[model samples]
Target: MTKIFFLGECMVELRELDDATMGQSFAGDVYNSAVYMKRCYPKLAVAMITAIGRDRLSEKMLSRFNSEDLDTQFVFQHPSKVSGMYFIETDSAGERRFTYWRNDSAAKKVVQFLNDDVVEQLTSADMLFFSGIPLAIIEQDSRVAFWQKLEHLKLAGVKLVFDPNYRAQLWANKADAIEQFNKAFQISDIALPGIEDLNVLYGISSAAEAIDFFQQYQLEELVIKDGPKSVVTLTGTDLQSHKIIPVTNVVDTTSAGDAFNGVYLGARLSGRTVSEAVQLGAKAAGTVIQHPGAIAPLAAFKQAMSEAGL
Candidate 1:
């Protein structure tokens, strides 16, 4: 079984329901991807690495992870800090707006809890996944240490996958985001970046420019997502574009990209070709947009795959 380690935060998510009520769950970029990946590939040993607080909410989050069958052995508990939270509000068109309450989240201190055992756990993984959000949350000093550990893991043959799930509000400034993202790209074997995010973050006006920028990093594979449009990809010297399977009803676009990342990686790890993986990823995201939250039910994912003949 493939041992996959995801390093990031899992926050308390409150989404506005149709009746004006709020539905609560646990999710984050990498965390959402982790959940979907586990559901897609049950035989894989999926684990999450992050810090959680010793609070009731944290306990509930742990229970949810366990119920999802995700390994939480690398998860750290902070005695005083609590988990971060965010509120999601969707518009008439199903686009999402977020309000964050993560200034002092326990996940921000994950680096402080890292030790030799944690290092071993990370380095031993077949693949390690993280996102731009994880880089944004950790302290600057801690980020140095975190990247150093990732460098060692990469040297040990653990493939690194990164998604530049860029949120403008998370970074202090554009320059800092660029710098950190560059550092991350250098270590990533596979890069999953959204064209919209790249355009906004790096001022790249077109898909070609975005693809060219990532190509400079010499990644083994690059996947660029453009909502409702064709996805651009590069594998070695080959460059290809695949169209998205459109979703007629998009309830929430909160985790569509995360869903794509999860299913795409799962498909590839299961020995599917790049074209096959992108199709599965597109199918997964198309299904997720019809749902209301970051994580659609495992049944929903399976149903989506079946409907797509994946």
Candidate 2:
């Protein structure tokens, strides 16, 4: 079985759609990926590593994780730190914008709880997944410790998948964010970056430029997403492009990229080729934008999977 470990925060999500209706859900980059990964590949062993509080909302998130049959044995529950929260507002065309309230989230301290056993768990996993936000949220020492541990895991042959989900508000300045984001890319075996993120972080003009820049790191597989345009990927010396599958009606695009990363990696882990994986990723993302929340209903996702032959 493919065992994957995802390290990041899962927060309480409040979404306001085009219809002006509001609803609450749970999401974070790695957490959303974990859910979609588990759902798409039930045989794969998936676990999330993060810190949460002992609050009611925290308990509810755990229950939701359990319902999806995700393994939480590696999760940490902090004594005092509270979970983070974010609010989403979507435009009529289904594009999303976020406002966060996560300055003091419990996940920032996750590295402090890491021990020898935790290191062992991560090193033995088939893959370790994280994003730039997770690294940016923590303290200097914690970030250092976390990167060292990840380096050790890489030496043990655990693949690293990184998403440079750059949020400018999370960092002290643009230069700091660029430095750390590049640092993460160097260690990443697979990179999933949005075109907008690259523009925000590196001032890149287009997806091709983003791919060319990251190609310097010699990533094993690179996928660059440009909303409603096309996805650019590089496998070895062969660069390919796939057009975005059209969404009939885009209701909200809150988790479009996260959902794509999840299904794409899930398919790849299940022995599909890079092209096949991205196809599934595109389909999953297209379906997600047609819904109102980060996680569309299980039935809706399954339907999309079936239609896409995922």
Candidate 3:
């Protein structure tokens, strides 16, 4: 089995259900992608490297991970801090607005638990996936330890996959986000970057411009995503364009990109060609956007994958 580790946070997610109620669940950027990928291909070893509290909410979060059948061996328990929570509001267009309360969340301390044994386990894994969220939240005091661990993974030849899921609010300034994103690209073997993230970080708008912007990196595989537009990729020096079949009714656009990242990487790791993988990823994202919330229902996702012959 090909083992992969996803390092990030999972928060208690609350979304308004009706005028008088709110629906609760567990989700975050990297965790959402990990869940979708693991569900599509259960044989892959998917471990989440994050920290949670010992409280009841944290326990429920643990149960959710268990229910997803994700490998929880790397989930650390924080001594005092509790898990984070966010409330989501969706508009008529299925666009989302978020309110977060994660300043002192347990995941911010995850770097503290990256001891020698954990490093060995990560080194042994085939790939490690993470996003800008972890890069933004890791405490300034613990960044040295975090960078050292990344260095270890690089030296051990672990395939580093990165997505710059940039949120301007999470970063103190654009320069710091740029610095971290630069380092991440330097070490990554595969990169999936959204045009929106690039627009925010580097003023990049289209996939063509994105390609020109990323030409400086030593990236082996680069996939540039433009919402509801053609997905573009650069394999070594060859660039290809894959059209995204549009979805007429958009219920929620929450995890569309994450869905693409998960299935695209999953398909590639399963020996599918880049073209096939991109089609399957488009299928995954299209199916996800037709549903509500970050995670679409399991049965629906499976049926969609089966229908697509993924």
Candidate 4:
């Protein structure tokens, strides 16, 4: 079985309702991908690498992970630390704004849990998936060590995948974000970045410019997703762009990119062609945006996959 390791943080989310009630859930970039990927490839070994506190919210999160069939052996539990939390509010168009209270999240100290044994376990994975936010959480020295371990795994033939979901608020400045993203790109075998994120990070206006920018690295595959327009992809020297099927309505756009990344990579790794994978990605993303939140119901996802002929 091929093993995939996703490294990131999962935060408890409070969604305010009309009746002045709050609904609790968990969400994060790579964690969203992990859930979908594990569902797509149930027999494959999928593990999430992160830390959670010894709290009820954390326990709920672990239960969800088990239900999702995601491996949690690599998850660290800290007594004093607390799990990160965020609150979300959405308007009529289902566009969301978030307020976070997560400074002392246990996942921030994730690097301290890394050692030779942990690195060995990570290296054993066939694929490693993560996002830029993980880099923002760790200390400078720990970040360097993390990068070194990734390089080691790459040399050992592990495929590195990254979604450069750049958040300006997470970094010191634009310059720092650029520098850190550059490091991840250097070690990455597959790059999945949103068109808007590329524009913000590198001032690259179009999908063509984004692909050209990432061409500087030794990346085996690169995908730049632009909502409702087209998804531009580069595999080796062959560049192809697939037009997105127009959606009649969009209920929410919260996790469109993550859904695309998950289904796209899942299909490709399962032997689908690039064009077929992009189509699946677009279909999955379109369906997700028509719903709410990051992880849509299992039935909704299955319907999307069926409609896409997956």
User: Which one is best on TM-score?
Assistant: 3
lDDT tens digits by residue: candidate 4, 37-80: 76666777888899999999999998888898999999899878
In candidate 1, stretches whose alpha carbon ends up further than 4 angstroms from where it belongs are 18-20
Best by lDDT: 3
Error of 1 at 34 (Å): 0.7
Question: Which scores better on lDDT, 2 or 4?
Answer: 2
Candidate 2, 1-310: lDDT as tens digits: 7899888999999875447686788999899888988888899999999988888888888888888888998778989888899998877787778888877788888998888788986777999899987988987777778888889899999999999998878889999888888889999999999888888778887977887688579599888888778888888887999887678798987778898999899999899988899889888888878888788899989888988885
**Model 3 — TM-score against the truth?**
0.98
The CA root-mean-square deviation of candidate 4, after full C-alpha superposition on the true structure, stands at: 1.3
Clashing pairs in 4: none
lDDT of each candidate versus the true structure = 0.88, 0.86, 0.91, 0.85
Provide the TM-score for each candidate, comma-separated. 0.96, 0.95, 0.98, 0.96
Which digits, one per residue and each the tens of the lDDT, describe model 3 over residues 165-237? Answer: 9988988899999999998998888999999999988999899999998889889999999988888999997
Question: In model 3, how large is the Cα lDDT of residue 294?
Answer: 93
Candidate with better TM-score, 2 vs 4:
4
Decide which is better by TM-score, 3 or 4.
3
Give one digit per residue, the lDDT tens place, for model 1 in 1-310. 7899989999999976668688899999888888888887788888999999999999999999999999999889999999999999888788988899998799999989887677876777899999999899899888889888898899989999999878888889989998999999999999998878888888876678987687679699999887888888899988998877688898889889998998899889989989999998888888888988898877877877878765
